[model samples]
Target: MDTENCTNLYLQVCQTFLTCKYDDPTTFDDLYKLLPWLRQSLTCCVCANVIVDPMSSTQSHCQHFVCGKCKGGKMILRPQCSWCKDAEVFETNQHLVVLVMCFKKICQLIASSPIYEHILNYDQQRKKELAAMKSDSPAKSDTPSKRKRPQRKFARTYVTSSLLNIPVQQVLQDAMNLKDVDINTQPPTVECKT
Candidate 1:
C-alpha cells in the first residue's frame, strides 16, 4: 500500500486506541493488541525519537518520516526529499498532528486533576526557592556594580462594548484594520498614593 493510505490507516487506528472505553481496569497489553503499529510507526526519521509533536512531513518518493527540524534543515540545503531526491513539495501529515494534539489534551487533563495537585505545588515551590537563592548570591567582580535598570512590563488591554460605547464585534473589526497603531503613543496614566 502507498504511504498516504498507510498513514490514514494509522490515523484511524490511533483514534480508535485513544477513544477506547476502559470498563474494567486493564493493562497496556489490551491497548497494544488494539493498535499494534502505534509504537513502530510514530517515530522520527532523523532523531529516531517518538514523534510526540506529530507535525511531520512525508517526502513524496522516499516516504520517510521526516520530523519538522530535519525537514527544515534539509530544505535549506536542497529542496528535495532526503531519501529519494524527489523535488516535489512534501505532503503534511495532518492525521498525525490531530492525534498528537488529542494525546496532549489527554495528558493535560490527567496532570491538572486533584490527585496531582500536591506534586504541582511542590514543583512550583522548588522553582521559587531556586530563584530566591540565585538572586541572593553576591557579585564576584571587584569592579563597582552598575545600577540595574527597572524593566517595563507591557500588558494587553481587552476592551468591552460597554467600556468603548460601541458594539464589541465592530470594535474588534476596526482594531483588526488598524494594525499599525503607533507604539510611541502612551496609555493614559492615573496617579495613586500607596
Candidate 2:
C-alpha cells in the first residue's frame, strides 16, 4: 500500500519473477533484473514501512531494514515484528547463521531454528567419498616383474678446481697482488709539479 510496503512486496515479487526465469543467477543480467525489482520491493517487514535509505550500497544491495516503532533505529536481519529486539522469541525461532567460505577464510556458524536444520551436509558427503576411496585402495604387490635391460654405469661429476685443491681466497689474493704491485717491483710513476 505505502512506499515501505511496496518495497517489501517488490522484493518478494522480484525474487519470484527472477526465480521463475533463472534463479541460478549465472549471469550479470539476472542480477541486474533482480536488483531493480529488489530496489522497488525495499520495504520493512516489521512495520510494513518503505526504506528511504537502507544504508551502505542502498536498499537493493543491503539487507538492513528499519521499522516505524524504533524511530528509524536499526535491527538485525529478519527480527521480530512487535519489538526491534528478538528477546521474546524462542532461541530456535530467532537464531540463524549464514556461512560464507573463501579460499583462505572458512566461516562457520551455529544457528537456532525451530523450522530448519543447518548441519553441513556437503562435508559429511565428502567424508563418505574419501572413506570409500580409502576402502577401495589397491593392495601392495610383493613379487618383482620379469623385466631386465642392459645397465649403464652412472658417472659422477668431479670438482677439478675446488676449494680443497686450491684455496679460492688465496687465488683471489694472488690476483689482487698481480693487479696492485709495489713501486719497488719497477713500474714507477714520475710526478711533475710546478
Candidate 3:
C-alpha cells in the first residue's frame, strides 16, 4: 500500500485495539506502554497531540515545536512565541518530522499485528459477558451508579502470552523487524530536542 494509506490503516487498527477493555488490564499494558514515548517527545505544545507537519518557533532560546493544526487554527505564533514570550516566526523542523515518521512506523507495526487480532477476539467475548450481566439485572441498567466488576491484574508476560496464545516475544520481534527499514540516513542535526 501507499504510505499515507498504510499509515491510516495502521492508526485505525491501533485505535480499535486501544478501545477494547481487557479482562486482565496487563494483557497488553506492558507491551502497549512503549508506544506513547514517541508522541510525548515530538508533539505540539499547543494541542499536546502528535505533531502533524511540525513547525518550530524561530527564537533561539525557545524553539518550541507546534503542529500544523495549532499553527493554522489558533495563529499561535502571530506576534510572539506562545511558549517563550518571544516574537518569532515558524520554521519547518524537518528533523523532528523525520523522527516522528520513523517512530510512527514502529508503532504502526506493533499495532497492526497479531496482538490486535487477539484483543478483538477478547473484546467480543467481554461484550457478550457484559450484555448477559446487564440483562440479568435489568433494573440496574438505567442506574448511573451501577457497580463495575474489578479486573484482577496478572503477570505481564504470562497475561500477554495467554491472551495471544503464542510466543509473545518472538511474534513482537518479528513484527518490529518486518521489513528492511533504514532510518540511519537522518541528518546528524536530528539529535537536537525541542
Judged by lDDT against the true structure, how good is candidate 2?
0.29
State every prediction's TM-score relative to the real structure: 0.33, 0.17, 0.39
Candidate 1 lDDT over 76-142, as tens digits, reads 1123345534423344455555544443343343344332343344446646887899899996888
lDDT score, candidate 3, position 184? 57
- Model 2: residue 27 alpha-carbon error in angstroms: 14
lDDT, candidate 2, 1-194, per-residue tens: 13344345444433543343222323223322332233323333333223321212122323334422333443423322343344222111100111001100110111121100212232354457878998999976778658857552321111111212222222222222322212223322467898
For residue 6, what is the lDDT in candidate 3? 31
Shift of residue 183 alpha carbon in model 1, Å:
30
Model 3 TM-score on a 0 to 1 scale: 0.39
Of models 1 and 3, which has the larger lDDT?
3
lDDT to native, each model: 0.40, 0.29, 0.50
Question: Alpha-carbon error at 13 in model 3, in Å?
Answer: 18
What candidate 1 gets wrong by more than 4 Å, as runs, is 1-28, 34-36, 52-59, 72-92, 105-194
Most lDDT-accurate candidate: 3
Misplaced by over 4 Å in model 2 are 1-119, 143-194
